[model samples]
Target: MTALNWKLVVDTRDAQTLADFWAAALEYEVEDATPLIDHLLKAGDLPEAAVAEHNGHRVFRGYAAVRHPEDPYDPFTGIGKGRRLLFQDVPEPKTVKNRLHIDIHAEPDGLETLVSRLESLGATRVNEVDKGPAGHWWVMRDPEGNEFCVA
Candidate 1:
């Protein structure tokens, strides 16, 4: 079977804000998408209502993304070729626990520092867990209430 390429899509109230948060949290770079947007606008292919200005650049109104800094990307569209997270605006709020969540592994002896940094980036610590021989970790929630973990 051929391997399929993919990026994680996250629903958010504000794509830009969520993208910013995740980018900082993961040390990733937000995808630009400026050249493509500008070209589309000038070619009458995209409507102004579907566009927004973020960080002084043109972006899709209800979408934003972040990618690993070292990942390959298309220069024209600024789309990532690997390791990306795409955020899309949604009208409804998160009402239940996420069945799928991200687990971030911290360096040895760096869990506390990592958790504190994430907190400063707008993450809330739900609780800490320590299982005798299993492991130790912290349950955390992002600004939009999406659950993730630090271990």
Candidate 2:
């Protein structure tokens, strides 16, 4: 088997809110793991201590995921079909730049269009990189300040 099952989970101050924002930003949805986890809890299959809330939001307190629409979901896991990003709750904020940031490629001239669309949804462009061999890109951050590049 290939070692290809890769998922990155970011620790954030707000898991649910981060999940919601990323759901919109990436055109993905929050994985509704609550029902399954809840059922396990009520059935004594899971420990009550496995769950907690952050910022008054009932979250998995460990991890949540968002995936692009038009994607398939794992019937067994109920996780997303396409590209996914997972968020988890942590006690602290992001202290430094991401070591592995995502780069989005799009029409450079129409960047304003994307900027407006993302901005209207709470994303913001932090910097504009110059055109070169790799082409130009915009450094944008999620609502939680997670940085990504848009080209």
Candidate 3:
């Protein structure tokens, strides 16, 4: 058997916005790809049209990512080598329930507080659901309407 690397890839209308949201939500760090972007552009491997300025630094227009704060990353490429979420631009909007969603676990008695914090960050509370012994959870959506749960 072979081990494999993985990271969640999400579709978004605004990569930077989504990356920022998730980075804060998960206490992750937004990967800084400015140096790589500059190098690539200078080498003519990445065209000027494929990049944009975000927070005073260059980033790939179609993609951005966040990494777990403790994870290792390639300093030159700003690529995360551990837990990560990559956001890529898509022309269409999200119009349906997500087949896959993230579940955020709160510390004991922390659910309400966490929910409020997420709301302040542009997340909407969809509803709360109770499943008997299985416990209760809140269904929420990110700014771009990606579904996730908090319990």
Candidate 4:
């Protein structure tokens, strides 16, 4: 059997804003799909309504993505080949706890600082958990209410 590749897809009301927040939180780069957009626009293959300006570049209007800086990507589409998160615009608001979530491991002795930084970047602290000798972590919600953990 061969290994599979995948990226995490998130639903958000504002894809660009969520993507920006996640990019900063993860120290990742927002995928730049301008080249592909430009090519498609020139070829009359893409509609203007499907494009939007983000960070001063053209991107797919209801979609945004971030990828680890070291990951390989296609220059034409700026789609990452590894470790990516794609956000898509949705009509409904998040109404319940996440079924699956991300766990961020902080550098040794850096938990508080990491948490603070994430808060400044728009994550809300939900609660802190302490399991003596087992583990400790904080439950956090991204701006869109998606739950994640920091440890």
Q: For all the candidates, what are their Cα RMSDs to the real structure?
A: 0.9, 3.3, 1.1, 0.7
True-vs-predicted CA distance for residue 107, candidate 2, Å: 4.8
Better of 2 and 3 by TM-score: 3
Residue 59 miss distance in model 2 (angstroms): 4.4
Show how many residue pairs clash in every candidate, following the order shown: 0, 1, 0, 0
> Which pairs clash inside model 1?
none
Can you give the lDDT of residue 69 in candidate 1? 97
Output the worst ten-in-a-row residue range by lDDT, candidate 1: 127-136
How far residue 6's Cα lies from its native spot in candidate 1, in Å, is 0.8
Q: Estimate each model's TM-score.
A: 0.97, 0.79, 0.96, 0.98
Over 98-127, each residue of candidate 3 has an lDDT whose tens digit, in order, gives 999999998888999999999999999999
After superposition, the stretches of candidate 2 with alpha carbons farther than 4 Å from their true spots are 1-3, 47-59, 107-109, 132-134
Q: Give Cα distance to truth, residue 141, candidate 1, Å.
A: 0.4
Ranking by TM-score: 4, 1, 3, 2
Alpha-carbon local distance difference test for all models: 0.96, 0.75, 0.94, 0.96
The top-ranked prediction according to TM-score is 4
In candidate 2, what are the lDDT values of residues 1-151, reduced to their tens digit?
Answer: 7656566788787777777877776667677666677677779987777776644434465677887677788754567756788887787879999998877656648767776777887888899888688577789998889898877
TM-score of 4: 0.98
